[model samples]
Target: MKELNFFKCKQVIENNNIHIWLINLEIYKKEINNLKAILNSDELSKSEAFYYRSDQERFIVGRAILRIVLSYYLDILPKDIVFYYNHYGKPYILTNTIDSLEFNITHSNEMLAIAIANRSVGIDIEYMYCGRNLEEYMESLFTTYLQKDLRMNTSEEKQKILLRLWTVLESYVKATGKGIRYPLSTDIRNIVNQHTKNLINSNFEISIDTCFLFKKIEIKDYICTCCILEPLDKFIIFRDEFILELPYYFEKIVR
Candidate 1:
């Protein structure tokens, strides 16, 4: 795995026409209080900014990490980057300068990931063990074909396969920005089959090529997946290599 260069802060590829940067949120908060300073403002207080659980905090931290990465990439102050929400409530940049910079982000366990391209993109991550009833949930959440696939596997292997399929489905949903309103029982194997056969769904007319990008990483006991809209050839994966040193401010509040 190639390590992303956070210190260099900018990556340029003329031939590929892609730029990517990664920020480890743990390191980010410790190295700079920029995100906290921005969120502390009275304006953002009107928004849902606090979560009662650590999982929610991790989500916010992942978003903050992306903001910091983009700030460095654009050479703009973090506070100056304007954000607005879509109808589905996904946050997106509001500047013309960002028109060409499509991005998506996901977090699982302690790691945050962001993918960028010059076109539309979406990403998703889920903890391998979310402490839920996997068998029951799959029966209700997946289509008949997907359920059949799961049933063919052993108990332990089924759990791992479930996470992998979950990431792929979640990525598709995120990419569509439809959230969970879309029917969970909808045929997913159909989509996967289309991808395999190079066929298009006539109703949606979505090209198999435009449908999904999937990658899975096993981190400790967790499985993390990243999905993007761009062609697979356009991606450059980077795992953060730097050690994180905690700042007293975060430690004080967290403790």
Candidate 2:
């Protein structure tokens, strides 16, 4: 929480540099009232439309937190920021303050993940749920090749592979802002190959690179991933709570 102050106004987010902010939705629950005050009328109406009390509160908190976080980068009041969504329903900053500001948001249960970068970026976080019919559910969403690979793996291994594959595919479509328009039937196995990672270059067409590029984020009890248009030159994850800290930094950011 204290560290968020150290984040200077408008840090130059480079084209290939991406920063991921992970927020635990529960932490902001206590401030729900204050959070709601920051939301605009449209957001408020959207929150009101939610049938469940918990869902409504979460919606309010998430939108308010997004505005607060973006304010630091845009150097504007949180309430003043506005968003415009594309044809596919992906949101982007509408301000002329900076043309490069692009972001994507995702949440699962109590976890909220946001990715911001100079270039187009997308992120997804999913709770790891290994249900009894996990394979059956995955079969409908995955290509035949991925399904075959999953079938050959043991239960534990299958869960791990299924998590990565599913999340990466999600992140890819989100990055493109194509949403469900992009076929789920893509054989993404070849793009995620280990050998390709060592050979990936920054300069490439959108077609081939989009198929091959995605970063997997390791969060306990969850599967997370991010995708960017170009090769990810720099990647940083800032969490509201101290959770998975490893080869990455151990400190928390954006309370």
Query: Judged by lDDT, which candidate is best?
Result: 2
lDDT of the candidates, in the order given = 0.52, 0.69
- Candidate 1 runs further than 4 Å off: 1-8, 13-34, 40-60, 140-148, 185-189, 192-211, 217-220, 241-255
Q: Least accurate stretch of 10 residues (summed lDDT) in model 1?
A: 246-255
Per-candidate TM equals 0.69, 0.78
Name the regions of candidate 2 deviating beyond 4 angstroms. 1-10, 130-134, 140-146, 182-212, 241-255
Which one is best on TM-score?
2
Query: What CA RMSD would you report for each candidate?
Result: 8.6, 6.4
> Candidate 1: how many backbone clashes?
0
Judge candidate 2 at residue 197 and give its lDDT. Answer: 25
Candidate 1: tens digits of C-alpha lDDT, residues 18-95: 333344555554433334444434434543455544544554556556665566556665556666767986666755
